[model samples]
Target: MSFSAFRILAEALTGHGGWKPMWREPEPQARYDIVIIGGGGHGLATAYYLAKEHGLTNIAVVEKGWLGSGNIGRNTTIIRSNYMLPGNEPFYELSMRLWEGLEQDFNYNAMVSQRGVLNLCHSDAQRDAYVRRGNAMIMAGADAELLDTDGVRAMYPFLDFANARFPVKGGLLQRRGGTARHDAVAWGYARGADMRGVDILQNCEVTGFLIEDGQCNGVETTRGTIRAGKVASCAAGSSSRVLEKAGLRLPIESHVLQAFVSEGLKPVIDGVITFGAGHFYISQSDKGGLVFGGDIDGYNSYAQRGNLPVIEDVCEGGMALMPAIGRARLLRAWGGVMDMSMDGSPIIDRTPVNNLFINAGWCYGGFKATPASGWCYAHLLATGKPHPVAAQMRLDRFERGLAIDEKGAGPQPNLH
Candidate 1:
């Protein structure tokens, strides 16, 4: 049932009893044209685009848990196209445009707010770097503006401008970048995919890949054997684990990235803010809570919980940026496993196993890249070629000594 104003009015007239489950909970089928592993935003989006854009509806999005159970739900919900690198800029800009019309396209309220995102600079070097990044963003067809210290202070007076250490020199602002409702994005895509005849099979964990003659044909799941013409994995932190079942070891490390939200208070932050002196970034939600996060835990593990050291470090960064943050009581926090790649960039290319595509190594940019990631992955799965914007995200880039190290931190998962 499509949601509309008339439907709401009719349901209201009928005592609001006409509502139904957003998507069907289907069991696994014997075979399908495409079987997507992991039911997070990317998988559901792949299924949705495969049906909506590629005209392939006989698809299955198999998930181990419920929708929005992974990084899609665990992120800070920030979205932007302020990337300066060519390998990453165009793809993210496409995603930013897609986010602009996502709700209208899917007929759901995902709350894609473009309140803007500001990256503060504490040093002259950082200000110069942001100037270059802003120029690059303009060249990539994304909006960006450089704000000096007075301009930033005029916008946000709560910041600690007088701090001798990490003084706010300037900031790079992307007026088009902001946060969205993370969980709603997953549900919207899932519902849209279901409406297009894609099967969303929850609780159906992939046990292994069905490989024959060096070609992947399907998957072995907890439910049963499912055959498919092709299979794709967007398992996020579990990307390596899923590929290992097929004896494919990826150059990806799994680390827990934690996020936090404070207790509700009066409106404070007008938009997203990042501290240049450290890794902390924050934004206020519509519900009055300040949502924030920082660097990933400095370790390699699959656990979804984080360590205290990281939490303490994140809080310190917050305090260094805005001393007033200490007055707000901490509400809660959670962690999502990150698939950190060697070059700190993502991969959206076919794996060594023919007929098996892989989408992994998103690092810290997964949430922001959801739409274009799915679009590109679907394009590749449907046509057996990489999308132009995502052509550089090949799995063999590292082996070929041409990694897209966005952070300039050479081959360090924890650093990125």
Candidate 2:
């Protein structure tokens, strides 16, 4: 559908004001077939898939805050499956496919724009890495094309193209990847799941896990206690804290990722662009705002605030790429906490704690992987087995020395 048609339909279903609360607190039931923590995109998508795909409707998505108040709402909303690692490739591919069908499935206009995403390379090593990633995408049946300097200039004329510090060389173009409406995704899944008899509990904080006989049976929350036969934690930043309450420690660190947006201007950028050398990316939102972001702060912090250096670095990168944006005034900036895993991939494995499962450690890519993460997470929770696509994200990989180090670097947060 055209972008205008998509926006019209979405606004009609969700109201012109965007995602507003549609349901209120339902009394905490004694037990649920499944209880998912965090009502962000991943959790809501999991609940929606469990009800729609698996015919499991007795689910409850418990959130500490309002829906989409987490990283789902905080991310830049870029969607792509341009992964180089084996473990991450198929899973993200599934997410990209799901993104293509989200509007139809949820009957909500997600405004998913497949305007494509370009990952620019500045060095020979980076170019080689892009080639490898492009090959992997092709092998996985996803659309990825390598572009040279002239090709890059032809596509994105606004870019400086010739900067002494960070010279533009080529890029890895994933034609199937792009951006989506972040808030609409949350509400689409929430409304779709709520319509299917799933209970969405907001403002309910999970304080502790109700472990019985070394097995998770329920969760103790701020509102009260609620039992569940199975529990999946999709809490991104708070994954470590939630798992710690269950006496589990993951090799995940909480870091802050900041995003910035310039004041609305006439549309200039038609697609998402990333600088591999400088760790920056920018995409124009449908609202005519330039949404952009960069690497996380090098330190660990639960505080969802970032330093000024990153903002400066990101804008510098943007100026190096698209000099025109240098004239654009940055209107707003915000930060979100991310669970940067030791491995740059996610962990979607069944825990040793019986019915407890996890779908965390997405780093900064969780928003894009929401749909596929939910699909795989629901499969794992329903069958008590890992799906083939997400099999490599097993929890034992860390102990087994089979880490899927995508960036070819050891398990380190800064490298990602």
Candidate 3:
């Protein structure tokens, strides 16, 4: 269905009726039961879950910029739960379950399309790795299929099956994994939380944390100070800056990730395809646009300027898989800063401060894990204890020499 029609249908189902506020003024001196910093998907979802699930209605989500205008707004919007490590497997599986019911629960369609995701393997070792991933998925009670070269070709007829350089051998296919409308995800949660009386403060940059006796009590923002019983940081790219302002240093490197989209055409790709060897992936949107992205920019910079190498590499991967797309002209490209954790997983536990909590890292997989992240984070905030789903993502995991390094790609920040 067209996005316009989808929007109307979403409104009718949600009872939110329609879109209204583009921007809302911030209240200067509002005291809330919970204050969540950085109004991205995680923050907004946390607020929504806190109110909807736990009945913690007095909450506020403070964003430095406009709502859904941060990394949550800038991601490639792929959703999947095919994880390798034990620590990450179950949590992401929980996220996948949440994605399945989001539309019914929120009464808003985020346009979550589960066209599936195929993680391609180029060699024997890679094929074995894919098998392991598939096994993990099955063990976790998630749907996954191990495909051979013939299986790959049968599913994706346009691929160059005979290419010697990176011949298609097989892949681990997660049938439930796919994409969601990134902006709508933020708006859906925002609307849901707003309906529950949670304040969403936009354009209100947080300047510092109000800590007393080594515990956070509130926050100081550009608008004014607002006191809260608890605070959670869901800031993605600017996480380090926010933490530093609060007199803490986290092992997160801020870097930029870029994605490209080609001019629309009749849909060809039916599902998300990731070429592991090439470090790239492509998925055709419902709009017929070829949405694609690749590895990080490989440097630490807040600047969102994307380098040419990764872009060229991504396009080359596209050409290798489906040569027909080579004729498609590039329309536009954009970038967003990602706060990559040292272990390539999220940090969703209480901070050293008594009442402060954290839900950062997330790397590139934050979008898919939004619901579960929020659910677990709200549990952490409400009960003052880490939920079973997120017990492995403690802040002290790195310091305690017990990192959950899921990618097995090493401790380097940019591997994922």
Candidate 4:
């Protein structure tokens, strides 16, 4: 049922018992026109857009676990289009635009908060670099503003601006960029897709692919054999393992990226902030907890747990940026397996196997790129062509010598 103010009032008047589950838990069907692997944000969004935008509803989004139980639920919830590269900027801008109208379009309260995102610059060189990045953001139709030390101080007065080692020189601010409720995004997509006649199959793991004569027509799952006209894998961290079953080795390495939240405090950080000297970023949740994260683990692994060194490194960065943060007690932390591509960019393209598509290698940008990723993937699956904004996110970009290395961190997954 659609949620509305009248419904709430009626439910409240009637003892508040009219609420129902967001989406149904349907059993897997034998066949579908399109089968999407993984029930995370991208998969559910692909199914939703395929039905809403492309008018194709015979889709199945199969998941190994409960819905939103992946990177979609394990993130700092930041969203922005502050990219510098042409290959990445436009696509993220599209995602940012989509995020602006997502809750209204899907009729759900995903909490798309545009509280702004500030990227601090610790040195003159970093400030100059942020100036260039801000220009690029403006060029891509995204909002950006270069903020001096005083401007940044006006926003976040508690920052360690006097640190001699890494003094805060300036920052790049995206007035329209901010955070969202990550799990609610997944739920809204799932509910929208299900309402439009797309099947969401949870707890049904894809064991293998139904490939014959170099074409994939279905998948072999833990439940049973399911046939499909086309199969798309949006498996995130499990991309390599899932495609390995089809004998396709990806250039993606799996690394665990950890995130943390602190004990509740009075409102402090009104917007997202990133430390320039290090890879730490943080924002305060509506519930008063300070949510933050840092770089991925240095090693390659599929386990959704992080090492201590990375945690220490992240905490150090946080303390370095805001000395007062050291006083807050750490409440808890969690990790998500990141599919880091060689050049630290995502890949969304048709694989070598006919009728089989792949959407993986999102690295650290997956959560922010959810809407555009799904929109582009659905466009590709429906039209057999890449969306204009996502044309550079091909699986063979590295082979074609066209890697979109956003960080200029070379081809190392650990560095990006």
Candidate 5:
């Protein structure tokens, strides 16, 4: 049902009992025009755009488990387009624009908040780097502002501006950057796709790909053998294992990235903030919990849990930035397996196997780039051509030395 003010009022008057399930639970079909692996944000978004933009509803989104059970529901929910690289900035800008209109487009309340994101700089060198990055963001038609120490203090008075090692010198602010309700994004996309007649198959694990003579015909699933004209893999951290069934080895590594939420407290943070000297970033949830995360575990693993050393490190960074955060008791923490590419950038392109496409290597940007990733992947699957903004995200970029290393961290997956 379409949600609106009138609908709410009607439900309120009628004892609030008219709500329905967001999406349908359909059994796997024997055949489809396309089969998309994984039912997270990217896969659901792909199915939505494929039906909405390409008029192809004969699609199946095959998920191993329940919807929104992956990284889509396990992130810090931050979103932004403040990038610097020519290969990365424009694509993220498109994502930012898509996020701006996503809730309206899907007819759901995804809570796409634009409360702004501030990246604090701790030294003169960092300030200069932020200035250059801010200039690049402006050049790419994205909003950015460089704030001095005084300016940052004006916005957040509680920050430890005089830290002994990492004193706050300035900051780079993106006024349009903020967070969203992660599960709602998945639900909205799932509902939109279902409304358009796409089959969403949950609890159906894909065992292998139905590959024959260098062409992908469909997938072999636990439920049954399904045939399709094209098969796409949007599995984030499981990309390598999923594609390996087709005899393809991806240049990707899976690492666990943990996120934490503190006990409910009075609203203290109005926007997202990141530590320049470290990877810690935080934002206050509407429920008043301080949600935050830091670097990924420095290892490869498929499990959805992390060790304690990284947790201690993240807390240290948070304490270093805002000494007051130490008093807030930790409520809970969870982990998401990140698909880190060699160059720390994502890949959304066709593979050597014909009729097979892959969208993985998102690292820490998956949740933020959900809409654009789906939009671009849908464009590629529909027309067999890379979307203009995502053309550089080809699978062969590494061999050609065209890596979009936004972090300039070389070819190390852990560092990115």
Candidate 6:
């Protein structure tokens, strides 16, 4: 059912009897033209674009569980396109643009809030670095502004400005960067794709890949063997495990990144805030809860849980940045597994096996890059060529000695 003011009014006047389910639940087909592994944000977006933009309707997104039951629902919901590298800036700018028109394009309210994102700088060197990043963002067609101490204070006066260890100096503000309703994005994309005849096969686990002569033809699933003309995997944290079924070992590691939210109170935070001296970042949700997170646990695993040390470190960072929140009781905490690559960048390209495409290695940028990643992955699957903006995200970048270390995190996945 189409949603609008008129619809809402009619439903209210008619005793609210005209509501409908968002999308249909379908069984897996015997075969499809394309098969996508993983029903997270990226997979759903890919299916949507394949049908909406490329007119390839015979696609299926196979998931081992319910839709939006993965990292898509467990994130802090932040979105931004602030990068200082040539290989990433343009691609993320495309994502930012798509986020601007996403609701209109999909005909669903994902609550794309561009309230703004402020990265606080604690030192002169940090401020200079933000200036460079802001310039890069502006050059890539994204909005950015450099805010001094007074400017940041005006926006967030509750911060600890005089802390000697990590005093607030200034901040880099991206007026278009903010959060969204994370699950709504997935549901909207899923509904859009379903309306276009794309089958969403939830609970259909991909047990193995059907490959012969170094060409992937289909997948072996829990339901049955579903053959396809092409196969793509956008399995997020399960990237390595899913691809390993095809005998391809990836240069990626999985780590758990925890997030927390406080009990709902009166609205306090106006926009997103990130501490420069540490890894903590926070924003207030629409329900008046303080949403926040920090660094990944210093280990590799698929478990969706973290230890106490990282929690302590995150709380310390939050208190150092904003002492007012030191006494706020955390309501709940959750973790999302991150697929971190060697150079802290994503890979979107054809693998050694023919007819197989890979879209993985998105550390912390998956939610923000959802639209652009899907557009580029659909472009590649449709035309057998990389999207111009995502041309540099090839799987062979390491062999060519061109690692896009956007965070200067080196080859260690934990460091990134």
Among all candidates shown, the one with the greatest lDDT: 5
Score every model by TM-score: 0.99, 0.94, 0.94, 0.99, 0.99, 0.99
Clashes of 2: 0
Clash pairs, candidate 5, are: none
CA shift of 295, model 2, Å? 0.9
Q: For model 2, what is the error of residue 75's alpha carbon versus the real structure, in angstroms, after optimal superposition?
A: 0.5
Which candidate, 4 or 5, has the higher lDDT?
A: 5
C-alpha root-mean-square deviation, candidate 6: 0.8
Write model 5 residue lDDT over 115-191, tens digit each, in one string.
99999999999999999999999999999999999999999999999999999998999999999999999999999
What would the per-residue lDDT of candidate 1 be over residues 73-96, giving only the tens digit for each residue? 999999999998999999999999
Over 97-182, each residue of candidate 2 has an lDDT whose tens digit, in order, gives 99999999888888999999999998888899889889998888788999999999999887877888788889999989999999
Against the hidden true structure, what lDDT does model 3 obtain? 0.86
lDDT per model vs. reference: 0.93, 0.89, 0.86, 0.94, 0.95, 0.93
Report clashes for each candidate as comma-separated counts. 0, 0, 0, 0, 0, 0
Tens-digit per-residue lDDT, 1-416, candidate 3: 11356687788899965667633454755688899998889999999999999999888999988888887788888999998777888999999999999987877779999999998888999998888878988898788998998899898988877777888888899999999999999988888888888889988899988899998999999989999899889998888899888777887998889999889989788889998778778898889998999888889979876888888888888878778778899998988888899999999987787788778888877888999998899889888878887899988897699898877776799887
Candidate 4: RMSD over Cα atoms?
0.8
Q: Which ten residues in a row have the lowest lDDT in candidate 5?
A: 21-30
Off by over 4 Å in 2: 1-21
Question: How do all the candidates rank in terms of lDDT, highest first?
Answer: 5, 4, 6, 1, 2, 3
Worst 10 residues of 3 by lDDT: 21-30
In model 1, the clashing pairs are none
The local distance difference test score of model 6 is 0.93
lDDT of 6 by residue, 53-169 (tens): 999999999999999899899999999999989899999999999999999999899999998999999999999999999998899888899999999999999999999899899
**Tens-digit lDDT track for model 4 on 53-153?**
99999999999999999999998999999999999999999999999999999999999999999999998888889999999999999999999999999
